[model samples]
Target: MAVFEGTFAGDVSNLKIAIVIGRFNDLVTDKLISGCQDCLKRHGINIEPNNGQVDYVWVPGSYEIAMVARQLALTGGYNAIICLGAVIRGQTPHFDYVSSEAAKGVAAASFQTGVPVIFGVLTVDTMQQALERAGIKSNLGWNYALNALEMASLMQQIQNTSSSPSAANLPPGNETIALPKVTT
Candidate 1:
């Protein structure tokens, strides 16, 4: 049996990445971006905005992250995309709709584009909890970046392997599945 896996120890310096951030909760999202940048930099990825291997895109809110992410993914320029946002629960049901849509949209973008889109949005019960996760205790943005790295590498491996004659011996499965394109 053959196996393929992605690790953080690979050379990601050449991989282009994009981070789409939601400015709705800058307090938490900003820290998340910091943590994410730290991880990518540690892994040898240049995090300079617009002039390096990574680009940062700011959206009005989490609700808009998906649209922008999908657009970027469609461009076929980025090896992976990381999304950062914070949606704290409020007294009203507004939290539910926004969080759910953001999650779904991020997933849809990845599925449609066959690109790695990391959903780093935080859906916390309170500001304290969001802060704690953002940096107070640990930052999930670091995790999100790590995920993007791993997925990007894995996808690359799969693409390369799939084209080889060895992949033809694998079990039979549908290889022509199509995903719907994202519309306005």
Candidate 2:
């Protein structure tokens, strides 16, 4: 049997994350939030005393996550934003529109604002799928949380590399240097 262990050694000490959850599927969203919080805490991020490390907000539904996330990213307070929602397929085409719009909107917000906006939304064909993804037994929330943290860390790395004068002035010969392998 293969075994996996959780480890946190990346430079996420000063990163700030904003979680915008959709109340449409409160249960699943809550699980996502819990997982996100656990991951953040494990990474040495402080969320209390107005430390401005982590914050969260609730919106009406999945369709509203993009707008709220965009607004939060525009505030220049958070390094990354995690949008959580669950859209279960219904009998109508409403699910298609909402899911596509939410995904595109979040992507647009990330590109336009230059902030890392993670799409943690679950677009499932059944409630069972959502439940399975949210349940601790399945470890889906843990997976999503890991994704969010990795994305946040990547964004920070990019920002840091872009802002450094030496990096900006890299010689053409060193432009394609390979990145070190990631152990975990």
Candidate 3:
């Protein structure tokens, strides 16, 4: 089997990143956003207005992240969008609905806009897990931001690659090969 994936060696200095955060769980989402910003800065990405290396937007809750994300993505100004939110499971069924919908919406936005929408939302059963993932122990938000950078660079590389191979680069008998469309 053949396997292909994005690498972490991509340059993030020139890539524009948007951070969509949820304010409902301000305690947790704040940490997540901090981690994401820290990671981007560590990789030499500027968060200035002119450079446009990073843009930050806050929504009321996780439920609204997708719509705003879709709008920003549609503008075609961002190379990647990172969503950060916390949806801790409670006694009610609200957790399931919010978490699932957020995930689906984020994915849909990415698919429809051809932009990398990295999901850093936490759907944990407890506050501890959410905090841990946010930055207490692992800082998944930072990791997610890095992932977005890698994917953006990878997609750009793939799109720039020729779908059709020249005769010289093709196999012995096959002079040409059909190239699959690499979606942004």
Candidate 4:
């Protein structure tokens, strides 16, 4: 049995997050939005701060999440982006296309911009699965929020490390110093 433990201790108080929600299944997506907000709030995040700590924008559907996320990342304003949506599989092949496209698009956006874009969109075959994953009754938003916070922290760390000069970049073995002789 494989257990998935969420172990992320990151401080995101100084970072900004952009949440792009898709309005496909309003009911399900709404719950996700609530979860995201509640989780963020629990982490000391103010989504609607007048001074701008977090920002939210609603897209038409799941397909648009990537475009919006990409735009936000490219603008270089937010430290991270969370794409939240619910695409319950339908009777047609359209389900596969939307779900896969959304996933790929989000991935592409994150890779291209070098920003952490979390994939909070739920692609389930049934409404029950979506609900279960969302932790509507079990309060699973905690997990999602943790994911966002951790990813944001990771990105920040990478950015900081890359910009700073490290010992490895210094002249080979130039860090060595002469040792003084002890009392004879």
Each candidate: what lDDT? 0.89, 0.76, 0.81, 0.75
Candidate 1: residue pairs that collide:
none
Local accuracy of candidate 1 as per-residue lDDT tens digits, 1-184: 5588887886776688999999999999999999999999999888888666998999999999999999999988888999999999999999999999999999999998998999999999999999999999999999999999998888777777667776666666835333222222
| TM-score quality measure for candidate 3 | 0.83
Model 4 regions lying over 4 Å from their true place: 1-11, 49-51, 137-141, 167-184
Best by lDDT: 1
lDDT of 2 at 93: 100
Model 3: per-residue Cα lDDT over 1-184, one tens digit each = 2244676664555677889999998899989878887888877788664665788899999999999999988887887899999999999999999999999999999888878898888999999999889878988878988888787776665544435344347557844322223222
Candidate 2 per-residue lDDT over residues 1-184, each given as its tens digit: 2223323566666667788889998988888777777777776777463666777789999999999999988887776788899999999999999999999999998887877788888999988888888774563555556666776666556555655676646777766232222221
Question: Which residue pairs in candidate 3 collide?
Answer: none
TM-scores, each model vs. reference: 0.92, 0.80, 0.83, 0.81
How many residue pairs clash in each candidate at the backbone level?
0, 0, 0, 0
For all the candidates, what are their Cα RMSDs to the real structure? 3.8, 6.9, 4.8, 10.5
- Ranking under TM-score, best-scoring first? 1, 3, 4, 2
Ranking by lDDT: 1, 3, 2, 4
Clashing pairs in 4: none
Candidate 3: lDDT of 176?
32
- C-alpha positional error of residue 50 in candidate 2 after TM-score superposition, expressed in Å: 5.7
- Lowest summed-lDDT stretch of 10 residues in model 4? 175-184
Alpha-carbon runs more than 4 Å astray in model 2: 1-11, 47-51, 167-184
